[model samples]
Target: MATSPLQTPISTRRAAILQRTGEALEARLEAERERIGLWLPVALGAGIAAWFALPAHAHWIGLLLALAAGLLFGLLVGWHSRLGRSLFVGSGAAAAGILLIWTRALWVAAPVLAAPVTTSFSAIVERVEPLPARGQVRILALPQRRSDLPPRVRLTLRAGQAAGLAEGETIGVRTRLMPPPTASLPGGYDFAQRAWFDGIGAVGTILGEVSRVPGKEAAAPPLRTRLSAHIQGEVEGSAGGIAAALVTGDRGAISEADEEAMRRSGLAHLLSISGLHVTAVVGFAMLLAMRLLALNRRLALAGLVLPLAAAAGALAGGGYTWLAGAEVPTLRSFIAALLVLVAFLMGREALTLRLVAAGALIVLIWRPEALVGPSFQLSFAAVTAIIALHEGPPMQRFLARRDEPWLFRLGRGIAGLLITGLVVEVALAPIALFHFHKAGLYGALANVVAIPLTTFVIMPAEALALLFDSVGLGAPFWWVAEQALRALIALAHGVANAPGAVATMPNFPPWGFAFAVFGGLWILLWRTRWRYAGAVPLAIGMAALLAAPRPDLLVTGDGRHIAAALPDGGYALLRDRAGDYVRDTVAEAAGVDAPLLALAELGHVECNRDFCRWAQGEGSARRIILASHGRDRIEGADMAAACAAADVVISDRWLPHECVGRWITIDRDSLAETGGLAIYLGEAPEAVAALRAGDAHPWRLPQQLSGNDEAVPKAALAR
Candidate 1:
């Protein structure tokens, strides 16, 4: 008979409890041990991130990194606890990642254009990507006879100017070229770094019609261009562009409206030629090869179909990857697909976190710089999430799909697809928000239909079309594919237009992003009760991201646009006449969807020919002085009065020191150094009162400050 708790000896009860606790601890350790190596990629990525995070101007960073390397090396070789050893391995991997990226950066570094220029130049067109809807063509050309210029320049030609130009052809043009641009705002995409890596020094726009010599013989155009032209010629409207993107990885012909719709609907991944596309292509090729080989009785008896199928899959994946331009994401997907094919050959389960981890490791080793990109993160995260979901006990049983009725099996398939879509969407949400400041709210729902449509209907039709097109009998299949694309594009636009489809927010704090990533990895990589603990940090990160304060005012690097938060819940621009690039950048950073209002039209400011003063805050707590009209130089007494009366003075022109404002004085000199400034009012958080565009790197050195390059005041830089 079992004794009651009160009747049992205290020592025995304590012993039982302690034994159970020990068992649990051991189980937890075992679970961690099972997948600890998977964290190697994460560690490597962290190292890459650390390298990017450190200021390039910091001379001691190298020494700091050396110390870290020594510590990690010691931990890696030393005998330690299992958890401790795993942690050390991760650290060592990170060190390796840092070194890899450093080497890659130096290897790919190329000369960049320092300033804008206008010249008449002859160039050999290496590539010509047409933009039919926009009546333009973008060409990547090797400029001739100019050693000072970069190896290549990307240029755009308007309708008339682009006539008769093709890849591998030579043409002359008079154009104004600009150095590749830095981020328009802090943490935005930097085109200059990408340009430097791609060996593009400048981007240009033709001033007039291009000068093409008469009867000039040139090499044939690239296969990709001809393929795109052929597909577009056969298919009409936007479907042709979609077909081209799917087939040749060229989206230049896709209409801007349709592209934006895809982005909003979260269907843009379809055009990216990643895992979905590669897997579909590989799977079809394997199935086809297996079926054809199985027709032979000897081959079937020998069971060679499976082996041949694996080979075919591998070949198909590699060929498609190359054909699709082999970008980082595509390469990562291809690696994963190849692993899947290998799994088939070895008779092992293909969908597993190990597969994801291995693919990630290969990619990080090959392209360490890609660690910072949204594509790499999204592709890996989505695949990992799906695999983790399948690894769960419930999913394992559900996916077994025993001998059931056809209807029930179909229902299970639908349910599985929906579940996977939701899981992928959840996995990608934080990544999307972190990089893009936006997330698709209904992306999963849209993809539920879109993915199957593309995989089972559209892609198969396209394949059949391509096969039959050699015999000129592909019209029927092409028509079917075109109809499917119409449905897909319609779905994209419809979902994008739905209410609350896209969620936008202010640029969240980097620390919050770090927390989210850590939490996500913890949850996805482990299979123990402790993994749920990750949700706490994840929730906290989401809170911080959603609740972060918005800035009250923003000043562009050039001091050409100054935007302020309006009392009624939008932003008012100092100048609305400027191009949409700056306007859109400011809007995105501000995290508002409303169009910027013209400050002058707001009718709240009192203005003179020299300046305009907007009284803000309780009892005019903050008076903002905005320089106006063609005047910047102010007489001593007048400037002193202006400064004393206003709390903040913002001007693109030089402001004298004697006329310092009551609070902050911002001028062209300060703007030149700061790049851009986002100022927060109210009870400013410890370090969030003002944020700058951050320190410059090699390709993004600060522009020169005009009118006495004197250092900005300490008070101005303090926040």
Candidate 2:
């Protein structure tokens, strides 16, 4: 195919153009080559993502392909096939990621509670989580001598019932334990799957009483829990709960209002044990160790100060991680922090995309499930954005201006914080929306103050208080910590209460989120000018809401709650007395935040004790929805009439054969398979269910739900 220039004499202009284009591409690729290794984790994550997106039937095939890729990659390497090696290696890494999660899932498999049981059991209390705000206590326990029960179960009881119980106490519990809950709505979080992975087969509430076991002895309370209790005691009110969260990673005591305030203000990350808290602990420990060691002239002369300080930092970080319950996010930050300290000891560039990739790769191997979590995405995105920011010329200049006046440097530092916060907010917006359906628009503004206050005042003071508490001299430090926490909480409340502080949208399409994630990575991972092109996909993702409007009808997994949007920009509920929690969740999922008015209250829909009829659209284009309200099912005669008239009929109970809807009929049996239904009405309507096609995972639904779904329209299984 290649003719020499002399054999196929091209025009001079065309030749010049081709040569210039080739040169430009070569230059771009050369830049990419410098950071090509960073793509390794991206490839690995891609495989993991593919596994989750895949149906249960395809899982084994995914594992096999990964194995094949690995074998092929080894062959290519041994054959010295350099060109083929790159292709196989990338695919092999991805495939390996698939195998990683598959193996992990199997490795952690445990029995799930099949049905609800209300009985008394002698259980060793593994952990007692206090919820002062809600006046509840969550008990993680191990049932003894009960072969019928799972090894571990979680119980929620009134705080007063378990007031004296601690981590090691053996307690008698009379509780109702049921299988962990599935997604509350279509695409909602799967508590059952997470519970399965956590070895918790059941979650329930104490129905009768909690008392100490006579035979077993209770050990001394754990230092972590003790610290949490002490911190909360030292600080008054809800601020104490936040302070405890900062120091111990236990957020059980935070009030609903405070949590909401913090979330809306974008300061919720402070409540979770992650980067900022870990960095503070490590950096402070290192600085303190270095300063103390420098006083030893011999240690300073031998140049062991930095190494020893780094060791101290690593030890402290590990300790803190353990104290924080070693949750995924805390563990992830600990690993990354450990790596950074190692890089420091090596006298290498400490922060780089390469470092970020390595950290991500390690976490993926250890806990591949974290790849799909918001914590992993948000934490990594923030760190990547900050590191990439420093690569920009403006930051390079700012960082290099060490000799500038102190006041000017202070001003510059504040400006840098503002810019960094803004940049991070933009990067995290899509992720927040994807997970929580809301993004704190003013999170950047809140973080500017909250971050500094937490880092410099609250956390440090809390640390000192803990240190001095060993000798009863911690009161002053405790006071200092409390005041700082009060300020932080106040700041959160103030920022969150502001108008338009957070923006919520409906569920964004998975395809759009994928594109946005890819585009964001492209911009942050590469240094070439091609990075600008990432904006195109990012724009497409942000425009997803406009492409699809809000759902016309929504129903809960239990079919107890149903809501529809009214023409007046409000909500009409089939149930006049739906619980606020159920109503709000459905409303938020439908991309609206409005009060729900009963169908009886809304003139557009006709409602009575037995049934409700809603007319959508006008003239021949209209669709009639006849919903069973007070009764489980319509009478045979009424059912036939409804079948002939209504476009769709919804019932929480099984309907007769004669009740076939003109377009679609959703009854108890259908709801049993679908879990939940979100139907968007239009010329060609679509329905999204809580359970998608081939969702036969044990944690998703009961095996008994294998009733033929072929009769249900395909749209009901839409993602």
Candidate 3:
């Protein structure tokens, strides 16, 4: 064995290399096993939850049948290794879950089929479109129809009359009832799905005669609403309207400039009834209750007093946690509070993971649709990450060091804010890209300042204002509250407008969302020294998002102008004439910023007219025209003439006449353009050329408009 020294060295080197490789392989296998172990139970629980939460119309029998089949399949798999047996169980549960899901889908479709004939209805206006434009109204109707109404609700109207309608106003309207619109892209906002879950069968505007129902008042505002309103009024009376919104999240009074400041500063969420606001209110209430209880046995009545007081605080603070429209973060706070109350009464430990999981399970069972909502995803991600980071040995030890100074505390808070923001953003980035196609670059910076202010200042002040109002000394407190609100609004607007505040993203598939979420969960749940392994899916998700294809055009509707299209797959902004703030809206909804930049960089020539035209040469093929006219005509030429031989036509209004060739409408277009195969966006000339260049059958044009008697244009040919 020791024949030569050189042989011995070579043998040792080979042994070392083999040992290292084997260790790596073993480690990978262990990770996979751990992952499966953790996920299997969660998946089974989810499956069971899904099964039990099926709606009334779901096919219970079908699901049971599927369960039976899955059980048999599981038994077959169980004949193999123990791991296979566990997997088989999980698979059986998953099969039942899938069956239930399918049943639910069928159930949802039943109403559409059974009740094909839709009825019209009239209702009072509860909330107007937050942003301005003509006739975009969010009305609550009584499920009745009226004669002499527009077939389709008219969203756009002339300025003055349309803007006059206010929240809490009753109005008569006739509308065609239908489901909410489905998402056009994967991972997109399923407005229809949300509406289905919310029980909104159809949504439309007012028509026919305008009549007011006297004495038929709106549903008495919730207790919180009344208190909030009272506080807002008091604040406006003393400080101003702008001041009121900053304190109370009632932005109806704030000035445009202040609003803009808050947005630019990334503090806009402070003004809204979100997690920050709710958590602050809850924490304050808890502290007050604890202090009051410590006074004496006589004052420390535990039965219902404390709970009642907390409930009152919740209600006064706009039912911060109980708001139907609240996002997942706020809901989590509410559930956590409920759990704490329960634990306090039952003499159990406080704030345990099991309690959190129970609360989450309850929510998921109640509203399965929320599983896909941004608020739910982001909130859970942040909470999970925080828990993981806190539990880590190094962080735990660091925090245990009591010698840390006030500066350290402050620094820690800031760091926590940034970390939380980054975690939530990473979890949500995929969906954001898939949905809005943009990212808030300064979201973390904005949160660092705004979050603390919201928790420590604005919300607390608002709560105080409400208390003062209840105590009959409302005026002084209201004034202070309003002033605080104004300040908050100013902060948000400032943050929103800051340079490099937002970055536009490319659209991605829904699967990207699944990957991102899985990666996040893996990182948060894994207990290992090499935590970076969790970044694999996160990285892939981001890469997938970056590589997503850009839309040929972006169309935006402020619920008024049918839609605004932007060339180069960027954003388009629809003007809000009434000056209502547009939240989380993107410019890309109107037009593509990247292509617009590219055009500028390439020194494309510009043409002056109602239609702003950019061109390089006659045959260069990249032609973009921004049609700005309201009437849909320019210099004796209709949209058809203006768009003739054009590759892409971006317009503010819809045009029916430009369906003859490969024209991409910017905003509005007739059904013909959307349904007809003759026109397409020229945004990617290469793709268009490829389609035309091939010796293949062209896209078939419709013989007639679907459901319409109109014939298809003979000259129209799809390429």
What are the per-residue Cα lDDT tens digits for candidate 1 across 1-719? Answer: 88777866887889899778756755676768878888888888887887776656352267446647766665654445554465566667777777777778778766666667777667788878788868888889887755666668899888677766777676777677778876655556667767756777789898777766566755566677788888888887788899988988888778878987999899999989899999998989999999999999999999898998889888999988887778898899889988888887788998889999999999988888788789899989999998899899998789785999999999898888888888898888888877777788898899989999999999899889988999999999999999999999999999999999988888777778888888888898988889898898888788888997767777776667888888777998887686777777888777776788887776887667677778654433454555443465677676888787777777877877777876777787877666567776554312122223544354555231112123223332221
Runs in model 3 lying further than 4 Å from the true structure: 1-137, 145-171, 174-190, 207-209, 213-225, 236-274, 298-330, 341-356, 404-428, 529-531, 552-586, 589-719
Tens-digit lDDT string for candidate 3 (1-719):
44698888899999999778756745653665544454543454456444433433234456666666766765764445444455466666555455544454445431211112233334445444322212133444332232222222222222333344555555553333433444322223446455544444444433443444555544555443444455544654323443443433445545556544554444444445544555566667766765666576655655655665565555534455443345455566677666766676677875544555565565654455565565565555555556666666766665564666899987876676686676655555555555566556676766776666656765566557566766677566555555655565555656666676656664454456556656766676667645577689877876776676554433333122212233334333323232222223323332122322222222343434344444412344445544343443544245566576555554545545543335444344432123211122343442111011221110111011112122222221110
lDDT of 2 by residue, 1-719 (tens): 87778755566778889768756755665667777677789888988887777768577585667658666865754434333444566777887877788788778777677767676667788888888888898889987666667788999999778766878676666677788887767657778878867888788898766666555555767888888888888886788999899989988778888898999899999988998999999999999999999999999999999999999999999999999999888988898898899899888888787788888999999989899889999999999999999888878887677777899888988889898999999999999888877889898888889998999998889899889999999999999988888888889899887888878788878888988998899888888789999999888888884465677788888776788777776667888788767776776677665567777667778877777887876556478988877855457776698667888888887788888888888888898778888887778877899877777454654321111112212222110
Each candidate: RMSD: 8.3, 6.9, 10.7
**Model 2: residues with Cα > 4 Å off, grouped in runs:** 1-28, 59-84, 215-217, 402-406, 617-621, 631-634, 701-719
Q: What is the TM-score of each candidate against the true structure?
A: 0.88, 0.90, 0.66
Estimate candidate 1's alpha-carbon lDDT, on a 0 to 1 scale: 0.78
Q: Rank the candidates by lDDT, best first.
A: 2, 1, 3
Model 2 scores a C-alpha lDDT of: 0.80
Task: Estimate the lDDT of model 3.
Answer: 0.48
Q: Candidate 1, which segments miss by more than 4 Å at Cα?
A: 1-27, 57-80, 402-405, 606-612, 616-644, 653-660, 685-696, 701-719
How many collisions per candidate?
0, 0, 49
Question: Could you tell me which 10 consecutive residues in candidate 2 have the lowest summed lDDT?
Answer: 704-713
The lDDT for every candidate, in the order shown, is 0.78, 0.80, 0.48
